[model samples]
Target: MRIPTVLLLACIPATAFAQQAQPETGSEWEVSSGVEYESGDYGTGTGTDIEILSVPSRLGMTIGRVQMIAAIPYHRIEGPSDVIPGNVLGLPLLPQPQPEADSVTRNGWGDLELGATYALPVKAVNFSLSGSIKLPTAENDLGTGETDYTIGAEVSKAISDKIIPFASFSYTLPGSPEGISLQDRYAVTGGMATWLGRKTQLSASYRYGENPDAAVTDDQRVQLGLNQWVGSGLSIGVYGSAGLSKGAPDQSVGLRIGFALD
Candidate 1:
């Protein structure tokens, strides 16, 4: 499948989300939002797919260490269609994900995710557990939506005074006829953050999740980035991701900017 930015991010969070977890839920009203654009080839052979571009924004809050998260993503894809010319085209030509056809082209919002998490105290480090629901908000006809929602949990552990390692897992329900045949969504991640000098902070991590399909599949991903404090409650960073699995994309890249407010 070939498409635009936002629409791609709107697909299954498990399939297109970052290697590290997106803290979308909590209690203290910790609001964070940003835009991202990426492109990748999803599979290989006749099944090889692609999402030309995708952009997604997110916001979340933390109350005494518990957080709630919510986000919306949009995407545009181009590939094959359901016609002869479409046969020449492929996935992104028909405007939607179809049963069997000559080609399919699509562009739209993928899915909505709403979830909550709690941080457990452990020495100088913080451990968190969370659960979320993946709302059916995309053009299932295109790529994502067959599932109604999902449930998830994550853990954060500190390795050193400034470095941390974390892991997570989640489950996705099946979809209706309007969405992708999302089987289950889950991932495990290890991450770290270090103070390079003063206002400069770097974060990096690796992630793995099951492919959202009717069959059993898995995906591996790596992420790296930096965070710098600009002023009072403003900061920015650049990030990128790469996929290492047969069930997932071959390559992906993007960036993010964030602002913290009270």
Candidate 2:
């Protein structure tokens, strides 16, 4: 049976809302679109595969000292379970069996986030506010699933004209009562942005998060990208991410394209 949009959204839980997958560019009234893929194991057992094709748009304008910003993210995910050896095997000498991912399902548009940011007026230092929600708009066949409403805030500071740094943290109130995927979560990250020279800009950030109610799948994410300006409003980049932990995937790589307008 095809999953309903509302039910699919409901299946995606608080965990989606709590992850810091995107970075703040703080460009006034600019929009960008990109595709991302990530592979990681579930808990310390299941192999996990996730692919996201997101077209995120941000609009920010400076008002005297503060920069007010708004953003939205839309995407999907597909996950499969893992298999291991069973504990007791005697008749025919065998190892063991453990299944992490019990089943598999494709969650389409599992979640969406809408939020606004306010940047403080400081010559070299800036602060921002981010408010958003994650719709359970994807398939939830993975067993650990729930609906959720989330809110978050973060800030960024620039060390020089060509360099910027930022950090973020947030809390969520899950709607599902069945003790869904992961748990209420906490996230922390820091990154730097710099110009390679003339028209190239490079940005990278390292993100870490913990599952508050469960210790099964804590995460450590590292991301890097190189942007080259082709014309007045056109740009492209090679982007990738990898998980650095026991239950995480080895690597994930993708591409990005963006344009700007007056």
Candidate 3:
């Protein structure tokens, strides 16, 4: 399955919102769309670099403490056919080795993802439980043509007015494709965010996870982001990541713009 890199960018603004005061007792709607581009060899010795351009859009609604979300992405991929796009926020699962060929490019819609999350705040700490499912909505090769499920938990605490620390863990159960057995995946992330002012926030995080194929090294990465809020409901952010192991992307950068609907 291919994961859109915009998901990483969207988190920055959400983190900023989470650090703010409690929400009003009502229903709220949010919509976000962004384009992300990334290039990396993914540690493939073939020396062929895969470039991915994704235009992802998401819609979400919150009622009480529960939030529901849906996302669909369009992707244009350029590289060797043997190299598949990996999960941007977690480990990259390697595909079965095939005969080497000239560089090829493919572009089309990616898989659809639907999810729900519930959040609770007790005193100073906030906690959340989330789950998502990936639908096989893309054409052959753009997706696995199989379904996948993920469950996660996250916690964050504000130690000061300007600083907030957070941690998250997730487990993914991926469907195996024809003639291949994919292992379950899990990841852990720890990070902190600091406010530079009332509307500007900076964040940094580290992630570690297992690759679907046990033969490869584990995934490790460090990510940084900066977000600025415009007016009351618009947010803009820039994010970057550096890979620490062979199972991760060498480098990535993305931008996101989000708007909250009243």
Candidate 3, run of 10 with poorest lDDT:
1-10
Q: Which predicted model would earn the best lDDT? A: 3
lDDT of 1 by residue, 1-262 (tens): 1111111121212212221233333423333345444443334234435445556566765454455667665666554532111000011222233433243456767566676656555444344555656555566344333334555555545455565455555555544443223344555666665657556656667777655543533667777766565665555656666767554445555555545444
Candidate 3 local Cα displacement, residue 210, angstroms: 1.2
Q: Per-residue alpha-carbon lDDT of model 3 for 49-126, expressed as tens digits? A: 677888888888767667788888787888776444543224333375433446788888878889887777555667
* Order of models, best TM-score first: 3, 1, 2
Model 1: lDDT equals: 0.47
- Rank by lDDT (best first): 3, 1, 2
lDDT of each: 0.47, 0.42, 0.70
Q: What TM-score, computed on C-alpha atoms, does each candidate reach?
A: 0.70, 0.64, 0.89
lDDT of 2 by residue, 118-231 (tens): 434334444445455544433333112334454555555555666656566656554443433334666666676566865676767776766433545555778776666776
Which sections of candidate 1 miss by over 4 Å? 1-33, 47-49, 81-105, 139-147, 176-182, 214-217
Flag clash pairs in model 3: none
- Clash totals for all models, in order? 65, 17, 0
